[model samples]
Target: MNLFIGLLNMAIEKDNDRALYLVQKAEVLAEIELFYLLPHQRRWRSWFPEVIYCRVDVEKTRIYIKEAIKKGKWNMDDWPEMKHKILKLLSIDDAIIDLAV
Candidate 1:
C-alpha cells in the first residue's frame, strides 16, 4: 500500500535511534512469529498475509490476552521503565528449552 510505503520511507529517513530500535525490535518479534503457527493457521495462510500470517502468533489469540510479554529488550532509546514492565509480562524461569521448541 502507498501508506505503508510512505511510513517505511519516513522510518528510513528519520535517522532516529527510537526508529531504529523499534525497527529492530519489530524484526526480531516478526522472526519469532513467522515460524510459530499452528496447523490450522498455516492452512489459512496465503502470500502477503500481513494481517494474519505476518502478525505475531499469540499461542491462542482466540482466548483473552492475560499478558503481553516478549523476551529481551522492549524499551525505547531511554525508557527503562517500559522495558521492565514489558519484560515482566510473562516471567519464565526456564525458557531456554521452550525457546528450542
Candidate 2:
C-alpha cells in the first residue's frame, strides 16, 4: 500500500513511467492477495471477497492515475474544474475511494 501511495505521488509529480511501474506492482500485489492469501484467511474472506476487492483496487488505481495526469496538466488553481471534468467523463464515483480499503 505504501508503494502504491508512493507511485501515486510520483504520478502526481508527472513521472509517468515510474507511475506506471508502480501501478503495475500494485496490481500484482492485489492479485496475489486476492488469489492466494485471502482464500486462506477465512475470517477476512466474508468482508473482502476476492473479485470485488481486486476490481475495486484496480479501479482506485485507475482513478489515481487519471487524477495525477490531470494534476500534471493544470495548475492548482485549475484543479477543481479539471477534476470535475475528468470525474464526469470517467464516471468515477467519489464514494469509491472511501470503500477502497
Candidate 3:
C-alpha cells in the first residue's frame, strides 16, 4: 500500500517522471514478492496482486488518476500511449457513460 500511496503522491504532484519511477519501483517490489512481507502491512499486501495487474476497480483507480490529472502530474503529450493505457485500465469510456446520467 505504501507503493500505491507513493504512486498517488507522484500523481498528485503532477510528476509523471517521478510517477513512472515510483511505478517501476513498485513493480519491482511486487515482482519480488516482498511487498507482502512487511509487518503490519497485511491490508495492502492482500491487494498487491491487483495493484500489479492494475486490475483494481475503476472507481478507485479513477480517483487517483483524476487527482493526478488535476494536479498536472501527467501530460498527454509526454506520455500519449501511457495516457491511453491508463484510461483503458480504468475503463474511462465506461466511466464516462456512468457519469452521463
User: In model 1, which runs have C-alpha deviations exceeding 4 angstroms?
Assistant: 16-44, 48-101
Colliding residue pairs in candidate 3: 14-72, 14-73
Q: What C-alpha lDDT, on a 0 to 100 scale, does residue 53 get in candidate 3?
A: 42
Stretches of candidate 2 above 4 Å error? Answer: 1-16, 40-101
**Candidate 3, position 93, lDDT:** 59
Compared with the true structure, all predictions reach lDDT values of 0.45, 0.57, 0.62
Q: Report how far residue 100 has shifted in candidate 3, in Å.
A: 20
Which is the winner by TM-score between candidate 2 and candidate 3?
A: 3
Scored by TM-score, the top model is 3
lDDT of 1 by residue, 1-101 (tens): 47545665677677654536466546644554567655566555353245522334444431222222233222234575654453345342234323433
Residue pairs whose backbone atoms clash in candidate 1: none
Clashing pairs in 2: none
Model 2, residue 61: what's the lDDT?
A: 58
Evaluate residue 29 in candidate 1 and report its C-alpha lDDT on the 0 to 100 scale: 44
**Using Cα atoms with residue i matched to residue i, what is each candidate's TM-score against the true structure?**
0.24, 0.27, 0.35
Q: Rank order by lDDT, top first? A: 3, 2, 1
Candidate achieving higher lDDT, 1 or 3: 3
Candidate 2 has a TM-score of 0.27
